[model samples]
Target: MNFSYELIEKYKETKGYTQDKQVISDFEEFNSGNMSKIKKGTRHLTANQCIEMANAVGMDQKEALLKLAIEKSKSKEEGKIWSDIVKKISAACIAGILAAASLTGQVVTPHLRYRR
Candidate 1:
């Protein structure tokens, strides 16, 4: 969940984004000081900021991106607990969607509903 770690990993995964400054340039709001705080785990990103990070990194899923943000805000054990909660939430969301579809006599694929 550490944003610095995820951001660093994304920097490595993305082609031609080889520097922290380059990554900062992709961010709409992050500055050098904010980046430093994020790296040091002293600052937290908001939900919208997390979504922006996901888009900047070309990640397709905001849920996973937000999970990283959440993880950065907690201790190791707390992060693990948070992950479990996320899993449960994700599962419940899917189940609810499926149940709703079934009640309405519709068959829907979860992935198909949220493309891109």
Candidate 2:
């Protein structure tokens, strides 16, 4: 899915990987053929691979997985439902940060990371 591709791309970008093979080599479970297939959108990554990439890119694992679910929805109606969930999850995370920051007398900004 596109979300998986983005996670993989983000991981590669952060690691300074110049080619798909570099990423393939980095993961013991990955092979050049599969990596190429994934990059070309002919194949999908396993959940573990997605989690690994999410970690490498400093993304929240739950959000990354939710995004993958959104992309994997079987129908437009289902995808819309997933998309709404992701939006609510993201908003809740931000709201929680703001609430905590308020209690601590600190200003929370949109660009700030709640985790990390």
Candidate 3:
């Protein structure tokens, strides 16, 4: 993941206007500790740490996290919807079988439903 100093600066500018001292304190603490330890000088933003800092700055961490979550949810919902469709098709097939059996003058008892 790419770290944008411009973006961070923009977020800082936006977030700095707030009355939240805790955020500024946390940013200072992170800069003094973890951020300072990275030797790559500004090129060391990992995906996880970006997420952490985004949260610290009161930015849209949920929106970023929800990217993956939304995709997973969409996939799950799509699978479920198609599974229900398949189930409906299977039920239609069963109904067709029962109709065929009835038309053949056979005694379509409830026990015959077990054939499905």
Local distance difference test, per candidate? Answer: 0.68, 0.81, 0.50
Predict model 3's lDDT versus the native: 0.50
What's the C-alpha lDDT at position 13 in model 2? 94
lDDT of 3 by residue, 1-116 (tens): 22334334445565664423433364544453443433234344445545765676665764434332332334678657655665676699889998898899785566534554
C-alpha root-mean-square deviation, candidate 1: 8.7
For every candidate in turn, the CA RMSD to the true structure comes to: 8.7, 8.0, 17.5
Error of 1 at 35 (Å): 1.0
In model 1, pairs of residues that clash are none
TM-score versus the correct structure, for each prediction: 0.54, 0.75, 0.29
Model 2 accuracy (lDDT, Cα): 0.81
User: Cα deviation in Å at residue 23, candidate 2?
Assistant: 1.3
Question: 2 or 3: which has the higher TM-score?
Answer: 2
Provide the lDDT at 46 for model 2: 77
Ranking by lDDT: 2, 1, 3
Give the range of the ten consecutive residues with the poorest summed lDDT in model 3. 64-73
lDDT of 2 at 94: 92
lDDT of 1 by residue, 14-103 (tens): 646666787667667868888777777777665666665566677655575647656564577877777788789889999999999999
> Per-residue lDDT of 32-83 in model 2, one digit per residue for the tens?
8887776677677777888888888898888788877777778899999999
